[model samples]
Target: MRKGKLYLIPTVIAEETQAVVIPPHILQALPGIQYFLAEDIRTARRYLSSLKVYESIEPLIFEVLNKNTKADQLKKFFEPVFQGNDLGILSESGCPGVADPGSLAVKFAHEHDIQVVPLVGPSSILLALMASGMNGQRFAFHGYLPIDGKDASAIVKTLEKESRSKNQTQIFIETPYRNNTLMAVLMKSLADDTQLCIAVDVTGKDESIRSYSVKKWKSIPVTFPKSPAIFLFLSH
Candidate 1:
Protein backbone atom coordinates (compact mmCIF):
# COMPACT_ATOMS: atom_id res chain seq x y z
CA MET A 1 0.00 0.00 0.00
CA ARG A 2 1.27 3.48 -0.83
CA LYS A 3 1.73 5.44 2.36
CA GLY A 4 0.42 9.02 2.60
CA LYS A 5 2.53 12.14 3.03
CA LEU A 6 2.62 14.46 6.03
CA TYR A 7 2.52 18.20 5.45
CA LEU A 8 4.10 20.36 8.18
CA ILE A 9 1.75 23.33 7.85
CA PRO A 10 2.70 26.71 9.31
CA THR A 11 0.05 28.77 11.09
CA VAL A 12 0.19 32.47 11.77
CA ILE A 13 1.60 33.39 15.20
CA ALA A 14 -0.87 36.19 15.69
CA GLU A 15 -4.63 36.20 15.20
CA GLU A 16 -6.50 38.07 12.40
CA THR A 17 -3.28 38.52 10.34
CA GLN A 18 -3.58 35.33 8.33
CA ALA A 19 -3.66 37.13 4.99
CA VAL A 20 -0.58 39.17 5.83
CA VAL A 21 1.50 36.34 7.32
CA ILE A 22 0.40 33.09 5.66
CA PRO A 23 1.06 32.54 1.97
CA PRO A 24 -1.80 31.94 -0.47
CA HIS A 25 -0.29 28.64 -1.62
CA ILE A 26 -0.39 27.27 1.93
CA LEU A 27 -4.01 28.31 2.24
CA GLN A 28 -4.85 26.57 -1.03
CA ALA A 29 -3.30 23.35 0.22
CA LEU A 30 -5.67 23.18 3.19
CA PRO A 31 -8.69 21.93 1.23
CA GLY A 32 -6.95 18.78 0.06
CA ILE A 33 -5.96 17.67 3.59
CA GLN A 34 -8.70 15.79 5.46
CA TYR A 35 -6.77 15.06 8.65
CA PHE A 36 -4.66 17.30 10.84
CA LEU A 37 -2.69 16.94 14.09
CA ALA A 38 -2.81 20.26 15.85
CA GLU A 39 -1.58 21.61 19.20
CA ASP A 40 -4.83 23.54 19.64
CA ILE A 41 -7.85 22.58 17.53
CA ARG A 42 -9.69 25.80 18.21
CA THR A 43 -6.74 27.95 17.10
CA ALA A 44 -6.17 25.81 14.03
CA ARG A 45 -9.83 26.03 13.02
CA ARG A 46 -9.85 29.77 13.52
CA TYR A 47 -6.70 30.16 11.45
CA LEU A 48 -8.17 28.15 8.59
CA SER A 49 -11.33 30.24 8.81
CA SER A 50 -9.32 33.47 8.64
CA LEU A 51 -7.83 32.32 5.35
CA LYS A 52 -11.23 31.17 4.08
CA VAL A 53 -9.57 27.94 3.05
CA TYR A 54 -12.35 25.56 4.00
CA GLU A 55 -16.01 26.19 3.25
CA SER A 56 -16.79 24.27 6.44
CA ILE A 57 -14.47 22.92 9.14
CA GLU A 58 -16.87 20.33 10.53
CA PRO A 59 -15.61 17.54 8.26
CA LEU A 60 -11.92 17.86 9.14
CA ILE A 61 -10.50 15.43 11.67
CA PHE A 62 -8.23 17.17 14.19
CA GLU A 63 -6.19 15.20 16.69
CA VAL A 64 -4.73 16.86 19.75
CA LEU A 65 -0.89 16.76 19.82
CA ASN A 66 0.24 19.23 22.40
CA LYS A 67 2.77 18.95 25.27
CA ASN A 68 0.29 16.81 27.15
CA THR A 69 0.22 14.17 24.40
CA LYS A 70 2.17 11.04 25.23
CA ALA A 71 4.60 9.15 22.99
CA ASP A 72 2.48 6.00 22.84
CA GLN A 73 -0.59 8.00 21.91
CA LEU A 74 1.16 9.36 18.80
CA LYS A 75 0.56 6.17 16.87
CA LYS A 76 -3.14 6.88 16.48
CA PHE A 77 -2.44 10.22 14.82
CA PHE A 78 -0.65 8.50 11.95
CA GLU A 79 -3.41 5.95 11.35
CA PRO A 80 -5.04 8.01 8.59
CA VAL A 81 -1.74 8.58 6.82
CA PHE A 82 -0.93 4.89 7.11
CA GLN A 83 -4.18 4.29 5.22
CA GLY A 84 -2.87 6.46 2.36
CA ASN A 85 -4.59 9.68 3.39
CA ASP A 86 -2.46 12.81 3.53
CA LEU A 87 -2.25 14.51 6.95
CA GLY A 88 -1.14 17.89 8.22
CA ILE A 89 0.73 18.80 11.41
CA LEU A 90 -0.30 22.24 12.63
CA SER A 91 1.22 24.10 15.60
CA GLU A 92 -0.50 26.69 17.73
CA SER A 93 1.90 29.24 16.27
CA GLY A 94 4.73 29.31 13.77
CA CYS A 95 6.06 26.21 11.97
CA PRO A 96 5.64 22.81 13.57
CA GLY A 97 8.54 20.81 15.12
CA VAL A 98 10.18 23.97 16.37
CA ALA A 99 9.56 24.62 20.06
CA ASP A 100 6.27 22.70 19.61
CA PRO A 101 5.04 19.19 20.37
CA GLY A 102 4.36 18.52 16.65
CA SER A 103 7.97 17.38 16.35
CA LEU A 104 7.04 14.05 17.92
CA ALA A 105 4.69 13.30 15.02
CA VAL A 106 7.37 14.36 12.51
CA LYS A 107 9.85 12.09 14.25
CA PHE A 108 7.45 9.19 13.98
CA ALA A 109 6.86 9.95 10.30
CA HIS A 110 10.60 9.81 9.67
CA GLU A 111 10.97 6.50 11.51
CA HIS A 112 8.18 4.97 9.42
CA ASP A 113 9.65 6.41 6.20
CA ILE A 114 6.69 8.70 5.65
CA GLN A 115 7.17 11.67 3.34
CA VAL A 116 7.23 15.01 5.17
CA VAL A 117 6.77 18.45 3.63
CA PRO A 118 7.38 21.77 5.45
CA LEU A 119 5.56 24.81 4.09
CA VAL A 120 6.86 28.38 4.34
CA GLY A 121 5.63 30.78 7.03
CA PRO A 122 6.63 33.40 9.58
CA SER A 123 8.75 32.24 12.52
CA SER A 124 9.19 34.78 15.33
CA ILE A 125 12.63 33.37 16.18
CA LEU A 126 13.92 33.88 12.64
CA LEU A 127 12.10 37.17 12.20
CA ALA A 128 13.60 38.48 15.43
CA LEU A 129 17.10 37.39 14.44
CA MET A 130 16.68 39.04 11.03
CA ALA A 131 15.67 42.35 12.58
CA SER A 132 18.04 42.28 15.57
CA GLY A 133 21.27 43.07 13.64
CA MET A 134 22.88 40.17 15.49
CA ASN A 135 25.11 37.34 14.23
CA GLY A 136 22.55 35.44 12.17
CA GLN A 137 25.11 32.96 10.86
CA ARG A 138 25.94 31.72 14.34
CA PHE A 139 22.98 31.71 16.65
CA ALA A 140 21.31 29.36 19.10
CA PHE A 141 17.59 29.14 19.96
CA HIS A 142 17.30 27.85 23.56
CA GLY A 143 13.49 27.74 23.52
CA TYR A 144 12.49 28.91 27.05
CA LEU A 145 14.59 29.73 30.06
CA PRO A 146 13.93 28.28 33.51
CA ILE A 147 10.97 29.74 35.40
CA ASP A 148 12.71 29.72 38.78
CA GLY A 149 14.30 33.10 39.46
CA LYS A 150 17.74 31.88 40.60
CA ASP A 151 18.03 29.17 37.95
CA ALA A 152 16.85 31.45 35.16
CA SER A 153 19.35 34.15 36.14
CA ALA A 154 22.23 31.67 36.16
CA ILE A 155 21.28 30.42 32.70
CA VAL A 156 21.10 33.99 31.47
CA LYS A 157 24.66 34.71 32.66
CA THR A 158 25.93 31.47 31.19
CA LEU A 159 24.36 32.24 27.82
CA GLU A 160 25.84 35.74 27.92
CA LYS A 161 29.33 34.41 28.53
CA GLU A 162 28.88 31.83 25.82
CA SER A 163 27.71 34.54 23.45
CA ARG A 164 30.83 36.62 24.15
CA SER A 165 33.29 33.76 23.83
CA LYS A 166 31.65 32.10 20.84
CA ASN A 167 30.25 35.22 19.15
CA GLN A 168 26.99 33.37 18.86
CA THR A 169 23.58 35.03 19.05
CA GLN A 170 21.52 33.48 21.84
CA ILE A 171 17.75 33.39 21.36
CA PHE A 172 15.02 32.35 23.78
CA ILE A 173 11.42 33.08 24.68
CA GLU A 174 9.16 33.33 27.76
CA THR A 175 5.53 32.54 28.41
CA PRO A 176 3.40 35.59 27.50
CA TYR A 177 2.40 36.30 31.09
CA ARG A 178 5.98 36.14 32.34
CA ASN A 179 7.41 38.40 29.65
CA ASN A 180 7.83 41.34 32.00
CA THR A 181 9.37 39.23 34.75
CA LEU A 182 11.86 37.67 32.37
CA MET A 183 12.71 41.10 30.97
CA ALA A 184 13.36 42.35 34.47
CA VAL A 185 15.63 39.45 35.31
CA LEU A 186 17.54 39.80 32.03
CA MET A 187 18.21 43.49 32.63
CA LYS A 188 19.34 42.87 36.19
CA SER A 189 21.51 39.83 35.46
CA LEU A 190 23.29 40.60 32.20
CA ALA A 191 26.37 42.81 31.98
CA ASP A 192 25.89 46.49 31.19
CA ASP A 193 27.58 46.32 27.78
CA THR A 194 25.86 43.14 26.66
CA GLN A 195 23.38 43.66 23.84
CA LEU A 196 19.77 42.50 24.14
CA CYS A 197 17.15 42.37 21.46
CA ILE A 198 13.50 42.20 22.42
CA ALA A 199 11.22 41.21 19.52
CA VAL A 200 7.67 41.71 20.65
CA ASP A 201 4.46 40.57 18.93
CA VAL A 202 6.01 39.57 15.63
CA THR A 203 3.63 39.80 12.64
CA GLY A 204 1.18 41.82 14.74
CA LYS A 205 0.09 45.45 14.61
CA ASP A 206 1.95 46.35 17.83
CA GLU A 207 5.19 44.73 16.66
CA SER A 208 8.34 46.08 18.26
CA ILE A 209 11.92 44.87 17.66
CA ARG A 210 14.60 46.74 19.53
CA SER A 211 18.24 45.92 20.36
CA TYR A 212 19.90 47.80 23.17
CA SER A 213 22.64 47.40 25.72
CA VAL A 214 21.87 46.46 29.30
CA LYS A 215 22.64 50.00 30.44
CA LYS A 216 20.33 51.48 27.88
CA TRP A 217 17.61 49.01 28.75
CA LYS A 218 17.99 49.99 32.40
CA SER A 219 17.60 53.67 31.54
CA ILE A 220 14.41 53.06 29.57
CA PRO A 221 11.25 51.93 31.32
CA VAL A 222 9.38 49.29 29.30
CA THR A 223 6.64 46.78 29.96
CA PHE A 224 5.62 43.67 28.04
CA PRO A 225 1.95 43.06 28.78
CA LYS A 226 1.24 39.40 28.17
CA SER A 227 2.43 39.43 24.56
CA PRO A 228 4.46 36.82 22.70
CA ALA A 229 8.10 37.83 22.39
CA ILE A 230 11.58 36.57 21.51
CA PHE A 231 14.77 37.68 23.25
CA LEU A 232 18.18 37.69 21.54
CA PHE A 233 21.55 38.22 23.18
CA LEU A 234 24.96 39.13 21.72
CA SER A 235 27.91 40.14 23.87
CA HIS A 236 30.96 42.14 22.72
Candidate 2:
Protein backbone atom coordinates (compact mmCIF):
# COMPACT_ATOMS: atom_id res chain seq x y z
CA MET A 1 0.00 0.00 0.00
CA ARG A 2 1.14 3.56 -0.68
CA LYS A 3 2.08 5.79 2.26
CA GLY A 4 0.21 8.99 3.07
CA LYS A 5 1.48 12.57 2.79
CA LEU A 6 1.69 15.06 5.65
CA TYR A 7 0.13 18.48 5.06
CA LEU A 8 1.29 21.44 7.10
CA ILE A 9 -1.90 23.52 7.08
CA PRO A 10 -1.93 27.23 7.97
CA THR A 11 -4.87 28.78 9.80
CA VAL A 12 -5.90 32.42 10.18
CA ILE A 13 -4.06 34.59 12.72
CA ALA A 14 -7.16 36.60 13.54
CA GLU A 15 -10.85 35.82 13.89
CA GLU A 16 -13.26 36.24 10.88
CA THR A 17 -10.32 37.03 8.54
CA GLN A 18 -10.47 33.63 6.82
CA ALA A 19 -11.55 34.97 3.45
CA VAL A 20 -8.80 37.61 3.60
CA VAL A 21 -5.94 35.34 4.68
CA ILE A 22 -6.86 31.80 3.53
CA PRO A 23 -6.34 31.14 -0.15
CA PRO A 24 -8.63 29.23 -2.53
CA HIS A 25 -6.22 26.29 -2.75
CA ILE A 26 -6.36 25.64 0.98
CA LEU A 27 -10.14 25.24 0.79
CA GLN A 28 -9.73 22.94 -2.20
CA ALA A 29 -7.31 20.75 -0.27
CA LEU A 30 -9.64 20.31 2.70
CA PRO A 31 -12.15 17.82 1.25
CA GLY A 32 -9.44 15.17 0.98
CA ILE A 33 -8.11 15.57 4.52
CA GLN A 34 -10.16 13.81 7.20
CA TYR A 35 -7.41 13.21 9.74
CA PHE A 36 -6.01 16.26 11.53
CA LEU A 37 -3.64 17.05 14.39
CA ALA A 38 -4.51 20.39 15.95
CA GLU A 39 -3.56 22.40 19.01
CA ASP A 40 -7.23 22.77 19.89
CA ILE A 41 -9.68 20.33 18.35
CA ARG A 42 -12.71 22.53 19.00
CA THR A 43 -11.09 25.55 17.37
CA ALA A 44 -9.96 23.36 14.47
CA ARG A 45 -13.50 22.12 13.93
CA ARG A 46 -14.88 25.65 14.08
CA TYR A 47 -12.24 26.98 11.67
CA LEU A 48 -12.80 24.21 9.13
CA SER A 49 -16.56 24.61 9.44
CA SER A 50 -16.23 28.34 8.78
CA LEU A 51 -14.75 27.52 5.36
CA LYS A 52 -17.99 25.69 4.44
CA VAL A 53 -16.03 23.01 2.60
CA TYR A 54 -17.75 20.08 4.24
CA GLU A 55 -21.36 19.05 4.55
CA SER A 56 -20.55 17.67 7.99
CA ILE A 57 -17.23 17.59 9.87
CA GLU A 58 -18.57 14.81 12.12
CA PRO A 59 -16.63 12.17 10.18
CA LEU A 60 -13.32 13.91 10.71
CA ILE A 61 -10.77 12.67 13.22
CA PHE A 62 -8.92 15.22 15.34
CA GLU A 63 -6.07 14.41 17.71
CA VAL A 64 -4.39 16.92 19.98
CA LEU A 65 -0.87 18.15 19.26
CA ASN A 66 0.14 21.05 21.48
CA LYS A 67 2.94 22.15 23.80
CA ASN A 68 1.94 19.38 26.16
CA THR A 69 1.99 16.63 23.51
CA LYS A 70 4.69 14.09 24.28
CA ALA A 71 7.37 12.80 21.89
CA ASP A 72 6.61 9.16 22.82
CA GLN A 73 2.97 9.59 21.84
CA LEU A 74 3.71 10.88 18.32
CA LYS A 75 3.94 7.38 16.80
CA LYS A 76 0.32 6.65 17.65
CA PHE A 77 -0.74 10.04 16.19
CA PHE A 78 0.90 9.18 12.84
CA GLU A 79 -0.77 5.79 12.61
CA PRO A 80 -3.49 7.01 10.27
CA VAL A 81 -0.84 8.33 7.89
CA PHE A 82 0.93 5.01 8.02
CA GLN A 83 -2.39 3.45 7.06
CA GLY A 84 -2.45 5.60 3.88
CA ASN A 85 -4.69 8.43 5.05
CA ASP A 86 -3.33 11.88 4.42
CA LEU A 87 -2.75 13.75 7.71
CA GLY A 88 -3.11 17.48 8.19
CA ILE A 89 -1.37 19.32 11.02
CA LEU A 90 -3.19 22.52 12.00
CA SER A 91 -1.77 25.27 14.15
CA GLU A 92 -3.88 27.28 16.59
CA SER A 93 -2.60 30.27 14.60
CA GLY A 94 -0.52 30.88 11.50
CA CYS A 95 1.45 28.25 9.52
CA PRO A 96 1.99 24.83 11.04
CA GLY A 97 5.60 24.06 12.09
CA VAL A 98 6.72 27.69 11.94
CA ALA A 99 6.36 28.79 15.56
CA ASP A 100 3.69 26.19 16.28
CA PRO A 101 3.93 22.84 18.03
CA GLY A 102 3.28 21.16 14.67
CA SER A 103 7.04 21.08 14.18
CA LEU A 104 7.23 17.88 16.21
CA ALA A 105 5.01 16.01 13.75
CA VAL A 106 6.86 17.48 10.77
CA LYS A 107 10.14 16.29 12.20
CA PHE A 108 8.65 12.85 12.75
CA ALA A 109 7.37 12.80 9.16
CA HIS A 110 10.87 13.55 7.87
CA GLU A 111 12.34 10.77 9.98
CA HIS A 112 9.90 8.39 8.40
CA ASP A 113 9.43 8.86 4.63
CA ILE A 114 6.20 10.80 4.47
CA GLN A 115 5.98 13.58 1.90
CA VAL A 116 5.43 16.89 3.74
CA VAL A 117 3.45 19.66 2.02
CA PRO A 118 2.99 23.19 3.37
CA LEU A 119 -0.02 25.24 2.32
CA VAL A 120 0.54 28.95 1.95
CA GLY A 121 -1.17 31.35 4.36
CA PRO A 122 -0.55 34.25 6.73
CA SER A 123 2.29 33.82 9.22
CA SER A 124 2.35 36.50 11.96
CA ILE A 125 6.15 36.33 12.09
CA LEU A 126 6.75 36.80 8.36
CA LEU A 127 3.86 39.24 8.00
CA ALA A 128 5.21 41.31 10.88
CA LEU A 129 8.74 41.27 9.41
CA MET A 130 7.38 42.34 6.03
CA ALA A 131 5.59 45.34 7.49
CA SER A 132 8.23 46.26 10.07
CA GLY A 133 10.67 47.81 7.51
CA MET A 134 13.44 46.05 9.41
CA ASN A 135 16.42 44.08 8.03
CA GLY A 136 14.62 41.36 6.13
CA GLN A 137 17.83 39.99 4.66
CA ARG A 138 19.22 39.05 8.07
CA PHE A 139 16.59 38.33 10.67
CA ALA A 140 16.26 35.79 13.50
CA PHE A 141 13.10 34.56 15.23
CA HIS A 142 13.54 33.88 18.94
CA GLY A 143 10.23 32.14 19.68
CA TYR A 144 9.50 33.52 23.16
CA LEU A 145 11.56 35.46 25.66
CA PRO A 146 12.03 34.25 29.22
CA ILE A 147 8.90 34.76 31.32
CA ASP A 148 10.74 36.29 34.27
CA GLY A 149 11.12 40.07 34.02
CA LYS A 150 14.83 40.14 34.81
CA ASP A 151 15.65 37.16 32.62
CA ALA A 152 13.58 38.54 29.75
CA SER A 153 15.32 41.90 30.14
CA ALA A 154 18.77 40.32 30.11
CA ILE A 155 17.94 38.27 27.02
CA VAL A 156 16.54 41.32 25.24
CA LYS A 157 19.71 43.26 25.96
CA THR A 158 21.83 40.36 24.75
CA LEU A 159 19.81 40.09 21.54
CA GLU A 160 20.11 43.85 21.09
CA LYS A 161 23.90 43.63 21.43
CA GLU A 162 24.00 40.88 18.82
CA SER A 163 21.68 42.86 16.55
CA ARG A 164 24.00 45.86 16.71
CA SER A 165 27.06 43.79 15.84
CA LYS A 166 25.48 41.65 13.11
CA ASN A 167 22.94 44.19 11.83
CA GLN A 168 20.33 41.47 12.13
CA THR A 169 16.70 41.98 12.98
CA GLN A 170 15.66 40.17 16.17
CA ILE A 171 12.11 38.89 16.31
CA PHE A 172 10.16 37.39 19.23
CA ILE A 173 6.63 36.96 20.57
CA GLU A 174 4.89 37.20 23.96
CA THR A 175 1.84 35.50 25.36
CA PRO A 176 -1.21 37.70 24.75
CA TYR A 177 -1.81 38.51 28.43
CA ARG A 178 1.84 39.27 29.00
CA ASN A 179 1.99 41.77 26.14
CA ASN A 180 2.20 44.83 28.38
CA THR A 181 4.90 43.35 30.58
CA LEU A 182 7.05 42.41 27.59
CA MET A 183 6.56 45.81 26.00
CA ALA A 184 7.67 47.53 29.19
CA VAL A 185 10.79 45.40 29.30
CA LEU A 186 11.61 46.06 25.65
CA MET A 187 11.36 49.82 26.21
CA LYS A 188 13.53 49.60 29.31
CA SER A 189 16.19 47.27 27.96
CA LEU A 190 16.85 48.51 24.42
CA ALA A 191 18.92 51.60 23.55
CA ASP A 192 17.55 54.97 22.46
CA ASP A 193 18.46 54.55 18.78
CA THR A 194 17.36 50.92 18.60
CA GLN A 195 14.42 50.67 16.21
CA LEU A 196 11.49 48.60 17.54
CA CYS A 197 8.51 47.34 15.57
CA ILE A 198 5.34 46.18 17.29
CA ALA A 199 3.03 44.35 14.89
CA VAL A 200 -0.30 43.56 16.51
CA ASP A 201 -3.18 41.57 15.04
CA VAL A 202 -1.47 40.97 11.70
CA THR A 203 -3.88 40.62 8.78
CA GLY A 204 -6.84 41.56 10.99
CA LYS A 205 -9.17 44.55 10.65
CA ASP A 206 -7.51 46.14 13.69
CA GLU A 207 -4.02 45.29 12.43
CA SER A 208 -1.29 47.70 13.50
CA ILE A 209 2.38 47.55 12.53
CA ARG A 210 4.43 50.45 13.82
CA SER A 211 8.19 50.99 14.03
CA TYR A 212 9.85 53.54 16.24
CA SER A 213 13.05 54.04 18.19
CA VAL A 214 13.13 53.10 21.87
CA LYS A 215 13.40 56.79 22.79
CA LYS A 216 10.24 57.51 20.81
CA TRP A 217 8.45 54.47 22.25
CA LYS A 218 9.08 55.82 25.76
CA SER A 219 7.29 59.07 24.98
CA ILE A 220 4.21 57.38 23.47
CA PRO A 221 2.77 56.21 26.84
CA VAL A 222 1.08 53.27 25.17
CA THR A 223 -0.40 50.07 26.64
CA PHE A 224 -0.07 46.80 24.79
CA PRO A 225 -3.25 45.05 23.73
CA LYS A 226 -4.22 41.57 24.86
CA SER A 227 -3.83 40.11 21.38
CA PRO A 228 -1.31 38.09 19.37
CA ALA A 229 1.70 40.38 18.81
CA ILE A 230 5.15 40.20 17.23
CA PHE A 231 8.09 42.36 18.29
CA LEU A 232 11.07 43.09 16.06
CA PHE A 233 14.08 45.28 16.66
CA LEU A 234 17.22 46.35 14.83
CA SER A 235 20.24 48.10 16.28
CA HIS A 236 23.09 49.48 14.24
Query: Clashing residue pairs, candidate 1?
Result: none
Q: Model 1 lDDT vs. the true structure?
A: 0.91
lDDT of each: 0.91, 0.94
> Candidate 1, residues 10-82: lDDT per residue as tens digits?
9888777877888878977778998999988898887777777787888989999999998899788899988
Q: For every model shown, what is its TM-score relative to the native structure?
A: 0.97, 0.97
What are the runs in model 1 whose C-alpha is more than 4 Å off? none
For candidate 1, what is the TM-score?
A: 0.97
Find the 10 residues in a row with the least total lDDT in model 2.
218-227
